[model samples]
Target: MTGLIETNETEAEAARKAEADAAARKRVADARKDADELAARIKVDGPRIVGELLSLARECAKQSLIAKALNAELPEGETPVPQADIVARDFGAEPRKDIRSRDVELWVVADDGRIVGDQAAVTSSDGITGHLHVAGAGLRWRCARRKFREVEFNPRTFTDWPGSFHELIRLPRLDGPGALFDGSLLTIEAAAALDVAASVKPTKRQPRPVQIELIPVDPTWPPATAAAPTEADANS
Candidate 1:
């Protein structure tokens, strides 16, 4: 009877251990399943979420800059120009007749109301038209100018570009150049691009900058020589 009781106790303990082990294995499997599902969801939604966040951030920055520009004090000779006026003058049914010569200086306003590129030429064929010919040697100006050319030449490539009123109202930066306001002018193509950018609402589509690929310089005089065959290549 004592032996039988001991045998029964041992069997009960073994059963409890088996139950615990089975529960632990089930818990691990459930955890792994959850982890896999989470990874799959992230793989599908991660890019979209990141894109939306970036768009939101850009819109916020653009609005903040615009507010700063609107509240900024003007320089002695400078006057504040409305964004609508600029658009009207450039895209109106009738062309402006009171075009100014290139000799006139129209400075680009920074977000902080500081003037940049004071020497930039403001020219117009029609008296009411204005064009800011940015000639600053600075890297920022160079990039801005290059981008303008790219958009002007290839407007179709960047149909979804974001344009802000502040960018046009102020000095155009490569990363954030906005609309062209009155009193200053951009090329018609540039202005059109800005108009497209401004009119479109922010969406999941990310605006990509025009990429200009550099052509490799062709070898002059002598062409590149081929590498000599190795011993292994000769054996093959």
Candidate 2:
């Protein structure tokens, strides 16, 4: 009789628990339905307001990230300042790709709002090359492509080839002209027209990859097919 009584009590408890769960589920469903009805009442403004709020949140997050990355703050008594000129680079160490720019700022001064020279002082990206004027340094020139070799000119030897020597200097597939550097620089036209053999000096330690000499531009010789000039050729 006691076992029967206990079983009846357990069944009653389970029934009550099931009823409670159903009520809780019904409340959740009703709450979701009410939210949907409320959203439907202000269909247009609701979406726009939500979108704007999300955008504002995103902007706040972005500013937070920028502050963390830069660790920036205004000095005491100074107002916040915005910069128009900003450049992006690879953020971390061990960068593989190098950032290259021909239009570079050569000089800058920050005291008392003073700045000198315009961007035009440097050559434009259009074909024209600019050379640096470095005192007492040999000018290094490279072929625009990975061709047979590079050419270096001694100071003040960059001039038109007079074709005085018997040997010929040949540079194949010339890709415009490169920069020339000396205490006083020369323009690209002046540098390209340089007498290669006269300007290039034989180095004692470094082996010359390609020997150059000046030969008369002959109709008999094929165009762009000249070899390195020998001692006999030079003597001739």
Which candidate has the highest lDDT of all?
1
Instruction: Estimate, for each residue in 98-182, the C-alpha lDDT of model 1 and write its tens digit.
Output: 4333333233333232334443354445533334544464323211111111111212231222344323343221222352233
**Where does the lowest 10-residue lDDT sum fall in candidate 1?**
142-151
lDDT of 2: 0.41
Give residue 8's lDDT in candidate 2 (0 to 100): 100
Error of 2 at 65 (Å): 43
The digit string of per-residue lDDT tens for model 2 on 73-186 reads: 656776444211111111223323434424333322222222224423333243233332223677422111111222333333222333211112122111123321231243
Off by over 4 Å in 2: 44-236
lDDT of each: 0.47, 0.41
Clashes per prediction? 9, 5
